[model samples]
Target: MSEFKMEHKNPEGLFVSKAFSQAITVSGKAKTIYIGGQNATNSKGELIGAGDLELQTKQALNNIATILASENASFANLVKLNIYLLSGCDPRIGYKAFQEVAGLLENPPLVTVLFVSEFARPACLLEIDGIAVIEDKD
Candidate 1:
């Protein structure tokens, strides 16, 4: 596992715990893996969380994690993350979910959570996509 740590240069920053700099930069040669939008459902095609942003966010992360694992990637290896959210929500609601999701990762990845008018199916409060790069370890 890579030694992933959060940087806190601006201690008085507004979003203190919610800000970070990505660990992996252009300096290293890493393998790339792109994970598609993952929602709060599992392989069984059932919704893990209903009508709840926090629960759904957790499930979405788990769903994304599975995809990453299949490709030999971990949150620590993530270079970018894209979060897609259903329309009928306060932006703060999505931000809250995102804050939790970021905390779950070993290190915060470059992220942009977009609020969309609709998703593949409704009732999904959040969907997450990930791009990761792991060193060759050679």
Candidate 2:
């Protein structure tokens, strides 16, 4: 199988930042992984953080990590991420936590953030989902 290539770009007229890419193009043989929404829920199905956006965001990111690892992938394989926070919540807290946990990637994935009025779980402060791609070794 041929190697997969991921090209991260920030076009000339667009704003660029270390936090995320404006766009990413993947080519060649690859396996795509779609991660479902994850919150602060732990392995035991118990909420890990309540009323704390930072902790909740970190736990959600960690949950995503576990899912990625199960498929032999990591944060480096991620191409896109969607984060949702409860309305009226401070996003800076969530962003800070994500940086602390996920750290900085050489090629960070494209990210989208939205504010919602509520979540399925009232105690939940945030949720995250992601898409990743990896070379097909087959």
Candidate 3:
């Protein structure tokens, strides 16, 4: 068993979403992992999807998953996610794509979706960044 604990909550007054948690309280010793913004790009830095929001969203989520694995963690370890969508993009597409992969997580993390005019890469449709906490081994 692990000493680290996390309490996820979605109060009655708040909008409860299957996609994400409203809040999370972390306790005990843990290691915090800060993941950088990831877009729909392959390991070779080439865009995976062009002019396709759903595909882009999935690729970005896959990138995040890869990062989490590198830290000896998974989606369940995520505490928060900041999602940036192109200003004119449809968020529903992104949400659906996320759900396809996020269904594996028993406790999804708190999420914030924002509309941005542009990203560092012009071809990028969306970007995702995450923060995760893992039980401290050291």
Considering every candidate listed, which one attains the maximal lDDT?
2
> What would the TM-scores of all predictions be?
0.71, 0.96, 0.94
Candidate 3 lDDT by residue in tens digits, 1-138? 788999999988998877889999999989999999999999998899899999999999999989899989988899999999999999989989988976646788999999999988999999999899999999
Cα RMSD for candidates in order: 4.5, 1.2, 1.2
Candidate 2 lDDT over residue span 1-138, tens digit each: 367898999999999898899999999989999999999999999998778888898899999999999889999899999989899999889878878987888889999999999999999989999999989887
Q: Which residue runs of candidate 3 sit more than 4 Å off their true CA positions? A: none
lDDT for residue 80 in candidate 1, whole number 0-100? 77
- In model 2, the worst 10-residue window by lDDT is 1-10
How high is the CA lDDT of each candidate model?
0.69, 0.91, 0.90
Q: Give RMSD (Å) of candidate 1 vs. truth.
A: 4.5
Quality of model 1 by C-alpha lDDT: 0.69
User: Given candidate 2, what's the lDDT at residue 15?
Assistant: 92
Q: Candidate 2: give the clashing pairs.
A: none
